[model samples]
Target chain A: MRRLYELLEQDTRTAGLTRVAVSTVAVLVVWQLVSMVVTNRLLLVPPAEVAVALVKEVETGAMWTNAVATVTAVTTSFVVSVAIGIAVGLALASSQALSLTAGPVLGALNSVPIIALAPLFISWLGLGFASKFVLVIMVAVFPVVVTTEAGLRATDRQLVEAARSFNATRLQIFTTVTFPYALPFIVSGIRVAWARALVGIVVAEFFGSFAGFGFAILAASQTFDTARVLGYVIMLGAMGLIGSVLFAALERRLAPWRQE
Target chain B: MSTAVRLKIEAIDKVFKRRDKPSIEALRNIDMEVAEGEFVSIVGASGSGKSTLLRIIDGLITPSGGRVLVDGRPVDRPGPDRAVVFQQDSLLPWKTVIDNVAYGLTLARVPKADAHRTAQRFIDVAGLHGFEHHYPHQLSGGMRQRVNVARALAVNPKILLLDEPFAALDAQTREIMQAELLSIWQETRKTVLLITHQIDEAVFLSDRVIVFSARPGTVREEIRVDLPRPRDLHVKRSPEFSGLVDHIWTLIEAEVRAGLRQG
Candidate 1:
């Protein structure tokens, strides 16, 4: 058994790809079998039917329009959240007084489920892109802030002392030592924030939106079009997978020294 | 050694106080001096607080009592006049070898081109020429420590304080680093103070080895090493060298035993 395990580990890249393919095929077969047994078009749809619906949605260009809307909202919220989150994180890390006063408040805010704010946001901003944008920012910014602050705090004390020995000023130490040391951590935080942003935009659209993946899913489900709903859900899953992969690549590019 | 005192420790005392626990005296009335162009080592047991003394001299730590003076001037804070090569590999993981070496110069606001040039010279001296662009994680443990030393030297400080800089390396690497350090010391001729528990290492590199007693550490003895200059690894085998090492070991052996009993 040990020998077999070692052999399997040798060509891990190829073996991993093959294993993924096999698992996907198994899932598809099980899904098709379940769908046939259920025999309820409203409740269940096979992979083939979902694929057909997805292609039709694409051909009609409604999927493109909804996708564009969701992507725009997510990207805008993500950019704004990262900028504000990093700035706030740096400030909190640098100032003991500010952190003492604000840390608990931020923690309290983070513990409150961001979706709970959807009604209040809609009441304030109305059922428009602005509400969705604000909702996404609320959900996404905390991870970046928490992780950035943690990273800066985690810098090795000896490194800081070495900088001090060189007579490095406070600002010089932050830019040259503290900030670069936290880059990898900040990148990982951004990845988590991206996923949260997607969730926020979708849920916001569900509450009230003229266009987006969540709106499309809600409209299809109202008519009991399970295949169209599944298509949009699958697209969201794909978007998340692609975003995480891209972020992983970005982490490697930005902090190659961290890679073993 | 020159007659001028480069660094003077005047009755320095360090007491670590905790919120609830009784304050522990780490060092008591520690007084010593390193003359100009002196290579001095402070050898003690693990809890002797030799490292604390070095940090005090570097101005990284404020002594609870007494003061540290360098060139007759009282030291209060970390300044470019003193550079420390820490026991741990403190190189910035995000920076390349060249950048880590140039860190001090950059902080001093030297032009980028001049900083890199000075850094390149030290990198070459430390035998890290081709590895300029490589990051800290990519280098071997010994190589990383070399970078640590080079970085300290690049700042051109008046005094170099090393806190067991080779304590983390394997035995073979430690010996190689010791020799390299000696050669670098010879070339630079800066006032050096090294803290270590290793008796032989202290004997081999220093012009004077000051032995510290266990807790509430105070200078127990200062042994002058008359070992001829331009020493090599073969010197360790010499009768005089072995005698000095044995003498220093004997001086600290009782302190170590006492420490063990207390713990």
Candidate 2:
């Protein structure tokens, strides 16, 4: 017990990690108790049953098939969104005319619900992964575009003046000063949009497709297998939380001096 | 100090326009000639436009009304021939000390390996020997200022334009930087145009001090500093340096008071 305590206290990072894990478990336990009190599996299942059902699905490869499919769709959509978003964002930021023209359209987009257009996507692209991909594109683009534009616009005036004082070519200023300074913001947009993209794919899949984690969850609900449905939701929650963590790690890796 | 008229500011005037208003003259009817390798300081109270004058000479800002000539040619815009060290260190935060210093060379399309090697030489001269790999955030305010100095010197401009480069520094750091600047200037003998509000810094560093009036800044007085080359900070303790400060202060004292009253 003393050795375990020493390990837990070895470093600030380790100590923080241990505290987070313990609190997470505690919260889950409390949630399980509350769900048990309700005594209705259909409304909410206990944590133990959810974990067991999760394991059983994984063992049967039911979870893997749907998880892999969902992951691939979301990832492909994210790549497309980021590429177009960054390009458009930078162009808009660099040109006042473009930003003025697109400002209203982007504002409308931020307020428009992705779910409101799910039926339209299904009708246009059919009951397949294509519609889900389009949903991810719409969900993901806004964040990336907004974040990248903000970041690009946020380039320091002093830095620009300094570069100008050097008679730096237009290309050099963009390559050296503006782009690097905007990187942190660009990564932030991508990370935030990624969460939105995942939600979009799931919603798109559930409403339109026959295969995917969303479909499996829907199937589980129809059969009243609440524990299995809980497992799929938990898996998604974990994937989202982990993906966000990976983005944080990536930002740190790219800006090592910012680690402190 | 050695060569005749390396730079000439001929009938320079600058007026800044705000939206829907008559233009405000920042500098008017200005004329001065700086000999090669001379260290000159332009001093005035805030808004007195001493900095604006330096910017005009550096071609960082255009004078709405007159002209600046370097080597008897008009300066239309900023070029590598004139390098400026701003009030803030202005080191690119993301880059390491060496990389920041090497940026001009890199922009000039010099090879990376060669740029680093060249940058290292000046980095040492600026007393930033051990800080080559350190980012601006990792360094002290003074250390970052040293990198700023190193960067300007890396390109080896014929003249250095310093706009209150030591103002951001603490008293102790300012002293060290002033000494470092003197040492660097003596070694290179580059023409330098330093702008400052500090009277002591002006008298300490300049061969000529061009004092400007409070607003619509015209040259109120130009005091020639006859102190010898390679003078130490100990010189500032001397009766000569003290007398020079008192002299320049006399020239600007009334303008400074009027500036305060207007504000």
Candidate 3:
């Protein structure tokens, strides 16, 4: 029974995702189910009509445009956050005074919701990609910084002492011991950051955007097209999910020795 | 001084200030020396300051009083001139075996190709030829300690300091490494100062065994090994070797029993 449960769990994770995916499809299917019960199109568009509407939007290339814009902003912000965050984390972990100073300030910033700062960001940088990118950076950078810092500081002192005994220099110690030791933490931080950055891009687009998944959904909502809006939402979720998996694969490849 | 002194340490003292306690006397008025190219082991109970003596002589820690001179020159901060194989190998996890072995030469600013060639040479000497690409984590503890020895000898220091380098290894491996180290010493003729709590290890490895008294450690007795060169595992079984081991054990029994109580 336990063996069967393990197999069930495995198949469930892979196949069960389809059921969860049915949330957006269920939005389409609900009308058909209701039609049998009440025969209403004015109340809810059928699944076929919503598919046609989604295709109609895609045929105009608007779907691709929204995708490209949101992706560009999200990717840029995520990279910026990862590079700066890890650098700062490593630096702060290296110095006691710097860690003491930066720790509290970063913690305070993390506590303040970025959503509440949307108006301020727009007012300061305008509603262009600049504001959205910064918003995404703000959302993404924290986790990377916190996690990388923890990783650096968490290095085994015994290994470090051993390195010193070998007459290893400061640069050598960092490259050999500290960086590799901190890799898992760095990967975790970046994974969470990617998710946050993607969410930031969508939220930025929802409030104000020339084009994005958020704009597409808002347009669908305005016309009371629940199926199209749900479709866009599913696409956004899929994109973030795929991005995280890709990064996780990269991390695993880079630090395969760590698992043992 | 008939054997000719290889190094001299005089009036060595150390005081470490604990936060709440009055200054603790770690060592005091310690004076000792090793003969030229002699393999001498310092044996003492834990906290008997055996390790501190080696550190001071290695120039990792400066003596609070007095001075240590290697070949008559006062010892300074750690230099490639005096290589150390510590309890911890300190191998960089990211560095491959060759890189870790090559670290000292690189710091000395040796040319890259030459340094790699030199490190590769000693890596072979340490009997770690094919494992050159492996990282510290990739090797067993004994293998890692071999890398540590290789790293120290890579610099070809005039003297070598070992602080129980094999204490972490299993008994069987320790015996094998002891033989390897003995052969290495025969080849390099390095004046070695090793510290260990193991009586048999101290007896088996050294040309002279310097035993220390209980805490605020002072040199209790420096029994000459009087054994022949190329000492083997069977040497421990010989009556002559056991005689020296028993003599040193008698001198250190009080401290060793004291240590067992606290530990």
Candidate 4:
């Protein structure tokens, strides 16, 4: 019976992969049909043209430059935002006075449409990496702060009492019980922050930047280079996909006990 | 059991006050003592505040009126001298069995190696010898409670306070765990104060059983179990054991009915 169940499970996994492949092919076919029917290269190029443009950009090293710039900006902003946000989050969760003062301010900031501030940041910081970095931090930091605080606040009361019964000091309880308990929440926050960082970097680049994926797309669209625009968009999508996969793996590693 | 008192609860009373609501008298004028190396159990109806009394003695909750004394010293705060196994499984879910067992020792700043070594001995005592690397989520309810007990024993506290530690387990597991707990307690000879609703469990493991009345809880009676130690499950089948269990159950049942009538 166990062997049969294992075999059935393998069959379902194989079927899932087959379905993904079939869906991709179907989408490509539909794209080809639409492109052929339209026959307007300026508006909608076929997937083949987009792929050719991608290769050409890579051959000329433009793709590498743009990829390197966006990757660096996103990673640096994400790291800084996570560190500062977690520190702020821990402070707010630890003290009622701090949370009461700062929590509503953060909630208001989060409610603002972050993209609207991109131009202001670029104007102030002078259309440079600093503006993009600041924009990404503003966009990405709130999720980390909010989720980290929520996670810490949700630490099990019974567990804390049990720790106290063993005479665990406050710091010891936080480190051993509270922090580890909040890890899954922190990782999820990082996931949201990552996607927001991508969006922020793109918006910052669009407002003003010398070079990046968003800049390349903006430049391509200005000249009606639809294929190149599509190529950069696909690259951004792939980056988001890779980041999401990595965060999911990290969540599993950090919180294996949370598996249902 | 030695005549020396390991724990003394003197006139402890607890009143819980809520905003916009009347105050609750949870425990009233409660007094008890546990001798050195004695296994005592408090059996009471629901809402009898027996668990609250255990928390007061563990120093997790302050008594509104009186205080708890451990070894001639007043307990104003939770300390290493007393350890508690809460009703709920309070294992650190992220930590493995060995790490969870060593948690108290680690908090005391025992070097990691020494803590793990001591934890290993208690793990063996708790009959969790081969599952050192398993997480709490991966263990059965009975096994988790075993780890809970092991964590408390690793600290080697002056007194072990268990608040219905096996209440969440199934009947078979509870009985098996009860037998194992008796063996472990016999081997360690630690002074233990347990709060349980299970009358048979109280009779099977305790040297003395203290019955509490319905809330505003107070000690209604204290029954000394004359049964011998090193007890196995078969002893639970004895007529004497059943008699003690029946007597305690009658007391608690009356309290339960009374509480229901008042409610």
User: lDDT tens digits, residues B1-263, model 2?
Assistant: 47678789988988889898887888889999889999988898878888888888878788888888888888989877898888885778889899999988888888999989989999999999988998888998888888888888898898899989999889988988999999999899999989999989988888899888866888888998888767888888888888989988888888788878988
Candidate 1, position B223, lDDT: 96
* Per-model CA lDDT versus the true structure: 0.91, 0.86, 0.82, 0.91
Candidate DockQ scores, in order: 0.77, 0.64, 0.33, 0.80
Number of the predicted model whose DockQ against the real structure is largest: 4
- Please list the residue runs of candidate 1 whose C-alpha ends up more than 4 Å from where it truly belongs after superposition: A1-39, A97-101, A254-259
DockQ of 2: 0.64
Positional deviation of B21 in candidate 2, in angstroms? Answer: 2.3
- Please, what are the lDDT tens digits per residue for candidate 3 over residues B99-162? 8888778777789898899999888888898999997888998899988898888888888999
Separately for all candidates shown, the number of backbone clashes (residues 3 or more apart, or on different chains) is 0, 0, 2, 0
| Local error of candidate 3 at residue B158 (angstroms) | 1.4
Worst ten in a row by lDDT for model 4 chain A: A4-13
TM-score of 1: 0.91
Native contacts retained, all candidates in order: 0.95, 0.64, 0.27, 0.91
TM-score of chain A, every prediction, order shown: 0.89, 0.90, 0.82, 0.91
- Model 2 ranges off by over 4 Å: A1-16, A35-38, A254-260
lDDT of 4 at B92: 90
lDDT of 4 by residue, A137-184 (tens): 999999999989999999999889988888888888899889988888
Instruction: Flag regions of model 3 displaced more than 4 Å.
Output: A1-58, A162-180, A224-227, B1-4
From the highest TM-score down, the ranking of the candidates is: 2, 4, 1, 3
Q: Give the higher-lDDT candidate: 1 or 2.
A: 1
